[model samples]
Target: LVGSATVLCTDKTGTLTENRMALAQVWLPSGEALTLKHGQPVSKDCRKLIETAALASDPHPSDPMEVALHNARGTFAGSESSSTLPIHTYGLRPDLPAMSNIWDDDQALTICAKGAPEAIISLCRLSDDAAQKVLKAVEDMATRGIRVLAVATSTAPDRQWADSQLDYHYTLAGLVGLADPIRASVPDAITECRRAGIRVVMITGDYATTARSIASQAGIEEGEVLTGSDLEALDD
Candidate 1:
């Protein structure tokens, strides 16, 4: 297959990137955003955002994003514990694309959710203006090659869990942007492929701007980016 192939299609995360995710930026609904530097103290709001995201994620996480959340929580919020386990969990679904966890906190149920920005925004039921502001923030982060996730929190009724995550009323906490640095060898490898007369194509679920930025870093030629919506509008 390698000898016969004239084109190579690759996923961006884990393939081109080191897969070691790092918390880089935070955007809040108050229109406050901050870019973080290593070994620097994060703002209180950013620390709260990371803590909430960590609560929403699995305690023993294997996914890169969840791992990053845990790491960030430790770095920003210190080694504090949740103390109580989650009473209920709403798993990520194709239709909603977000997940929520309900925890028993001092006889009250606290819900935390994190996932795709669109899903969380919908869950928060933000006004048109607020939603637009969030979308703009998402775009700005994506343009910088940051993978963004929306974070939210809610209060749940005792012993009455919803069948779906959508039933709860959530407040948008903030957005977290994770950075996955490209692998060191990718650019030279891509150049070698070009010299060998092969075309390199990046396939990712990331935003078009993010894909374009990573492609440029990896030495892939600038070309048309077809998103899911764009593909749906095309004829097969």
Candidate 2:
């Protein structure tokens, strides 16, 4: 089968990338962007953003982005024990790609959420101008091959919990950019596949810009990107 194969289809994350993501950039609603470095101190607002993202993630996370958030939180803020435990959680759903966690502070209940920028932006219900600004930010990040996730916060009633995260009013805290570098062996492997007359194709759920960028790095030629919406609109 391998000898007869003419095309190879692949996923981006674990296939092309090392799958070890690192916190690389943060963009705030104020339009300020910060680049993070190892063993460096972060601004108070950036630290707060990292903390909130960590709160939104599971206490023990297996997902690459969640692990990156937790690692960033630990690097910037000494320990995770300083934060309060979550009282409730809204897991990611098919309809809503974001997940939110509610924590009870002494004064009130605090809600923190992190997920796809579009979903978080919708949850925050930003104005037309604000939403445009965020979409532009997401585009810039994606062009740089950064996987972006928007972070948000809100307050919940003391006695009542929302059945869905959308029920709460949320404020856009910021956007976190995670970088997953391409695997060292992928480029050479791709080149060899092409030499053998195999047509390589990459299929990913990532943004078009991101997919194109990674595809270029992995030595795959640029090609038409088909999104899920595009696929849905297509006919067999």
Candidate 3:
């Protein structure tokens, strides 16, 4: 029965990449981005972005992106935070591609959010001109074969609101480009699967450019993408 199976559907992050991601760059709303290098000084704005991602992420996330964001935060500062505590968590959902939470330190309450560039942009109250520029930057990064995430921060007015009450009225902080290297064995694995008459289809929430880049590297045949709306439009 296993041998008779001809189709294999799989996730992209762990199955394709090594799951070890590195922060490559950060783009602010002004079209300015910090090109990160090891052991270098991170600008105040960039540090704030990384810190926001860390605070909003899961305490111990199994997702590769969250893990990368957390590690980047640690490298920028040193050691996980010992003070801040989460007050509310807006977990990720299909409609809301981002995740956010409110954290409280002794001083004040802060709201941090992280997610797809477009999704994050929608949450931020950016002017139309600013939004277009940020989207262009995101596309540029993706064209260079890096995954991009948008991070934002705001002041939490209500300390205890239900997740559903969370609003998209936040500051447009910045965008982070992360490099998720393709796994060394993926190309060979795909080759073997093809030899066995199997068709491999990758379905992921990653950007189209990122997906296409990895697919090309892994020797997987690319086809038209069916997004949520596209699926809904299907006539099956």
Candidate 4:
């Protein structure tokens, strides 16, 4: 099977980029973006965003993104909001492309959601022009060698309603741009694979631009990207 194999499909995380993740930038609902480098000042909007992330994040997360979120929350939110907890959680799934949490605040309910920009945009119920604008922003961020995740919010009268319906029709809040370093050895590995007569392909849940960026860095040949939506269309 080794020599006869014509194609090698691989994941992007450990296979391409180093699995270590860091918060690069954040685009808020107020149309403000803050880039976090060596420790930039956190604006009120950014603090709120971090607090939301803290509320939605796992206490002991093994995922890189979750660790980043919690670390960011600690940097900004501190210990005041550490007591907050989610009443309900919609865990990440392959089909959902997003995860959500509902919290009770002063007898009112608030929902915090984080996920792929495209997936969250669909649930936001925005106008055509607005959706396109956000989509454009997402694409722009991805092309800049950053992985983008959109944040959203929605309110229900109570937790029961929020739990009953998976789609709460959230409103777009902002986007977070994360950066993961590409492994130095990846390009050389790809070259050796090519020499062995194997056609390498990068298969990932990441957006096309992000995947393409890493592929280019790892010296993978340029090629068309087939997204999940594209694969679904072919099935139809």
Q: Which structure among the candidates has the greatest lDDT?
A: 2
Task: Give the whole-model CA lDDT for all candidates, comma-separated.
Answer: 0.89, 0.90, 0.79, 0.78
> How many backbone overlaps does candidate 4 show?
0
Model 1 — TM-score against the truth? 0.94
Which is the leading candidate under TM-score? 2
Per-residue C-alpha lDDT of model 1 across residues 1-236, encoded as one tens digit per residue: 78888999999999999999989899988888988876788778778888999999987789999988888888876755456678889999989989998887677788999999999999999999999999999999998889999999998776578888889999999999999999999999999999999999999998788788889988899999999989899987
Residue by residue across 27-139, what tens digits does model 3's lDDT show?
A: 87766777788888877777888877777788777777778888888887455754645877887888778888877765666778888877787788677888889889988
**C-alpha TM-scores of all predictions:** 0.94, 0.95, 0.84, 0.85
Model 1's number of clashes is 0
lDDT of 4 by residue, 1-236 (tens): 78798788988897688988887888876667788865567877787777676565665678898788778776765544455567778887776777887887777778888888777887787788888888788887788768888888888764454443255878777888888888998888899899988888998888889888878888889999999889888943
Candidate 3 runs further than 4 Å off: 1-8, 158-168, 192-199
Candidate order by TM-score, decreasing, is 2, 1, 4, 3
Q: What value does the lDDT take at residue 204 in candidate 1? A: 96
Global lDDT for candidate 2?
A: 0.90
Off by over 4 Å in 1: 80-83
| 23-77: candidate 2 lDDT, tens digit per residue | 9999998888988889888788888998899999997789989999999998975
Judging by lDDT, tell me the better candidate of 1 and 3.
1
Candidate 1's displacement at residue 153, Å, is 0.4
